[model samples]
Target chain A: MIIQKPGIAGTLESSDAQVTVEPGDGKIEFELESAVINQYGLQIRKITYDTLKRLGIDNVKIKIVDKGALDCTLKARIEGAVYRSCNQYNDLPWGGAIQ
Target chain B: MKNPNMKRLRRTMMFLNAQKPGLIKDPYIYKPDSIMLDLEDAVAENQKDAARFSLYHALKEIDYHGVERVIRINGLDTPYWQEDIRCAVAGGCDAIRIPKTESALDIHLVEEKVLAAEKEFGRPEGSTLLMAAIESARGVMKALDICDASERLFGIALSGGDYTKDLQTHITGTGIELMGARQNLIIAARAAGKQCFDKVYTNLNDTEGFRKDVETIHLMGFDGKSIINPRQIRIVHEIFTPSQKDIAFSEKVVKEIDSKKAQGIGVFTVDGKMIDIAFYDGAKRTIELAKASGVYKGEL
Candidate 1:
């Protein structure tokens, strides 16, 4: 689904990641900041890219401020932001891709 | 993995705000019999849409070990409950807790949606369970009808926070304001063959007060309490543990019943307490609880 506008999910809490998705050009603009960036930064970026791709969106500016969140939390926050951008609140495919 | 049993031990169903990812991730570590992923009171109104996203994902990602996963959705009167069910059932939540349930129709409405979601999600039909929160005097008065409303219902819980507001009264030290409502709810749940839970004790500072309420409700035949904090879990479990005397007496009842069954005798006196087949289940359940609580010393 196409993202309608700027969408965000998660919180600036420990073990969570605050993700924001906004309109972008034909390129995927990704910015990430986390305490574990040096150790898990590449993994986090891959997960974000995979989650965004699974939601069928790529051309968006993604900002991730992670706080030691697990891969599952990252994926969930990313998907949530994607759906919020598209303004789809109902009928969430919970067991969907990036699970 | 136990298929969510209707008669599972639900001594404490702690309410965790679903929007809080940190709290929801590992609440099972405390070993509450159930964890209620709250989507109503704990969540802010503007963030209801956001909370569902987290709730659905947490329910999918977390294993939750053996602790029962319950989702306390918004009331049927609200616009959020149907969508809440869609997320909960798809995530395979063990039970859906309906808030401010006033009548049988409320449960029927949720049941209809739950069935549809189960079908749409390819879950086993009738796998999801439903519970109602009686939040007003009208709901208390209509308790039996509500309890008998749905076959998928495992029980009903009294939400004292809202009920007190509807009555224009407040909680008292001795629980006089809540005693009648609690009695009626337990009776209705028992009559309908469903488990009943006590309302949450809001005061965490008063350990003595909480203890009194727990003991009182246990005697009043409540299966559990909707708690907010983890500190209450140990206290509730300790209170629910079968004492040594209780275990011995229950063991004697079971042994005597087993031996007397050959003689076709259904009634007997165990330690001068009249016991029969009706008491058999209670006796066995005591032994099971004793074993589970690690207080049982007998070989049998």
Candidate 2:
């Protein structure tokens, strides 16, 4: 369930955020660029980190490009990318997975 | 979400594509009586999962604030419908709209999945509801059985495009091609004591034609119409509102009917028009319609 060849998730459209994940240096390093940086930068980063935590990934280089996505859309896109990167397509716990 | 009411005002149920975050996010702002998050014809085959994710979130997060939330799932004939139900239930949508439904089995099959999803998601059993889209000649013919198939069914909607295609006829503004099917479906819905919605008017640009169709369907005894755009909402609601004279006379009849029944008068006359117990329900319903349409300020 560890980072399998750097998974990416999310979209770059307005009200959506795009995230790219890769193997990290034994620590969670987060990078974010958002049109609403002055207002919602921290909120975007927090959503990305929380999604990663729920998916049980402790360390990864996560890049997020935000177009002002709502919390749920951001969460889904990140979750999609993580699952896609790990090649775990079947039996996704769509609502939320067990830790 | 408000608790499911078998009889609710759904004069305009607008369809929003499930995958579009922007559209699904705040369609309630337009104030359609119901918002149908579509996972069937609107979604691309490859994007079903993505659409489900978006749909689940929209249901969970959007505070539609008294607007009925209906999920239009893929047909029972597809592999995607079961999962679609799970997502809809988990997200707590008010009802499931089954597309391409032709028989009672379609309702029963989806009802079983809905019940299973309710249990799996810890939702109250029988909390979710269902309605069918009569899309073909077979569906039109079997509309009665379909409407009576389950108690979860609140109504049946006429899906005109598929129905017309099945008849192999072009849709003229006259609506003659669909007259029989429409009449048969409405009669079936009425016989089952269920609400029926007219088919959508697809010509977005034809306001004149849309107005005529709405007038025709409204007079055909449909409870409502499946409106595709916001521009159509006000007109449908306006047309469906009981007129001042109709509402005033209905109120009088409803009140007099109550007193007459107590006096054991089985029949009477109001304004020289014959009145009886049979007209009581229709009169009460007109008052209800007037109140719902914001046209009645009278104390009924």
Candidate 3:
């Protein structure tokens, strides 16, 4: 899926990436193939896990394709993807499927 | 080397405590994610010794829960810097904010001294992290090298006041003049795989302008922005947080993607737009922010 926001907050030039997240029965998968990851290693994974756990997602698979994305861009992209997949945008203060 | 379960939610920290007695009490009580008790810029020439003593005692006595304690020592160029480093290390600071770093050599200099002091004081050798304050044009130019200088380095901050003066540029609220510098710093920090922060916005009374500036900086990709006043902390935090509408939309996207994948669908539509693996990635990030900001309380 291609998600693009021409004007977003923060420095958007150097730090941009593509991530892939898939959820299943009590298991979510994530994969990342980011230039940022190739350059900086798996630092963004650390941030992603932290964010997912906090959201109370215990079983997940995530894939990312990074191109030197910043913290905000990483967060925004992951968030947009999760919301789109879960179909929980209409509800307030969402409680995830597993919980 | 990476812990998958670490949250990116760092508290907004403000630097405080100088040679002056009443300065700490000037800002609101119990705010900011952390407070850097500075014996550096805010302290006067004669009061360095006293400030160190006060800082040590304060660390020993103060109960700053949820508030990380950091110390900014005098720059390495000065005679007082060594002693300042020793005192802060001995005083049990969370990190040492080193100033005017031009290269990795500067970080190593302070790291060597800090290590020696840690050994002498029976403190753990790697207990303290180093924060590099990039001031001056040279420092900005070599930020990436300085960031990767040591594993002890945790974060890098833009010292706007000194940087501007050193570059012979005037400071402005719009910060258009500092955009290149800011972008450079962020790029360097990211390249080095470290957290980068924006410089302090000096206009104390211009709360609206400050908020706008924070949003701009936040959008530019900074983890956090420095604050001279307690008032600015909340404003920065608010701007950094993801919105309600954003959270809901992200949730919908994730659900739809999952349902489609279950039916062996590789691609689908959301709101009349094509959806695929890449779209799922952005949706997950929205959920992550919602979780970080306490908007989502679900299973990971």
Candidate 4:
């Protein structure tokens, strides 16, 4: 997904994938570009956003340029970026989102 | 450049305990001499940007209790490395652990990027330290030059797992194949008057084995071991501390050296070995360890 709305329930869309938000307690939207859309398009897109949701982050917008990243690499990069953006400083109450 | 005497380096236990979000909340509470809030391997790829943001916020928010803070950014070979360095330095990290450094040029390139980051962040020049993780054979070979390439270069580390993989060596706790690399890195770091650290022991269930490995590395002259589990911290601390007898002997050497100097003697014999200025250097190091470890609280 290239763009995601900033709210509890949002729409996610990508070149090869789309998911409807359940409007549940905790859900987030993350979107990114795949440098190698033919090789790692679906898996990279799914994992980048799935990780944030798993971490209980209710809302996010991710833009990934995947250069043939595998499942592991996709997960690593998304987690790295999310943590960095949220952890620019140590005083925020971003406790449950950061490890 | 902020504080020259701050070079009295502490043996740093950089913790890598980020499993769940709250799992690593109070990294400083663990009392690691350094905290490496990892954003590379421990994090997944798609989450790279988010993790970077999280790290930036964490560093800005968390009170790390004077513990030295570092960020293990992705390798320079990756697309994420530049942004990682930029955000890490801008967020006030003391050092950036450059991964997969295979040559002096790799370190030089990273140094340039870090210098730019420093300037961009308007940080004091030379406020950040560059720690190169030599994870390949080439990195080991060029370690000395890498260490000497920049004054901002604080130390080098031996990442055992990747090095073993790069060398196509079998993995085991024995670390037999890594012995040569470990020893060489220590020699290289010491030759450059810099610090060197051993890699993390991944076997969390094998605490005894981990302790033994820490002892081996400590005996081999490593400054410290990168610990993956908090359970392993005490083992590393124990291994790095000088024993009571060793501390006493070091104290005796210092006292004897003082008396001899007072009597106009330049040297003396300890246990039939020639004890000269060189011996005093070792004795002084032992005393410093004792002081740092809180074993020698008296005034020097």
Which candidate's DockQ is highest? 1
Docking class of 4: incorrect
What docking tier does model 2 reach? acceptable
Better of 1 and 2 by DockQ: 1
Model 1: clashing residue pairs?
A: none
Docking class of 3: incorrect
Which residue segments of model 2 deviate by more than 4 Å?
A: A1-12, A20-29, A59-61, A86-91, B1-4
Q: After superposition, how far is residue B261 of candidate 1 from its true place, in Å?
A: 4.8
Across residues A14-71, which tens digit of lDDT does each residue of candidate 4 receive?
A: 2121222222234454455555677667766566556666556555544565444334
Better candidate by TM-score, 1 or 3: 1
TM-scores vs. true structure, each candidate: 0.94, 0.92, 0.68, 0.74
Interface RMSD for each predicted structure: 1.7, 2.8, 20.7, 11.5
Report model 1's TM-score to 2 decimal places.
Answer: 0.94
- lDDT, residue B64, candidate 4: 75
The Cα local distance difference test for each model comes to: 0.89, 0.85, 0.69, 0.68
Residues B1-300 of candidate 1: C-alpha lDDT, one tens digit per residue:
223578778889999999888898899899998999999999998789878878877888888998999999997778899999988998889999999999999999999999999998899988899899999999999999999999899999999978988999988868899988999999999999999999999899999999999999999999889999999999998888888889999999889998899899988898887888888899898998788666888877
List the candidate numbers ranked by TM-score, top first: 1, 2, 4, 3
- Model 1 has an lDDT value of 0.89
- CAPRI class of candidate 1: medium
The residue ranges of model 4 lying beyond 4 angstroms of the native Cα positions read A1-99, B2-12, B15-20, B266-274
Provide the global lDDT of candidate 3 against the true structure.
Answer: 0.69
lDDT tens per residue, model 2, A6-72: 7665556677667788878998898888878889888887877778888889878888888878888
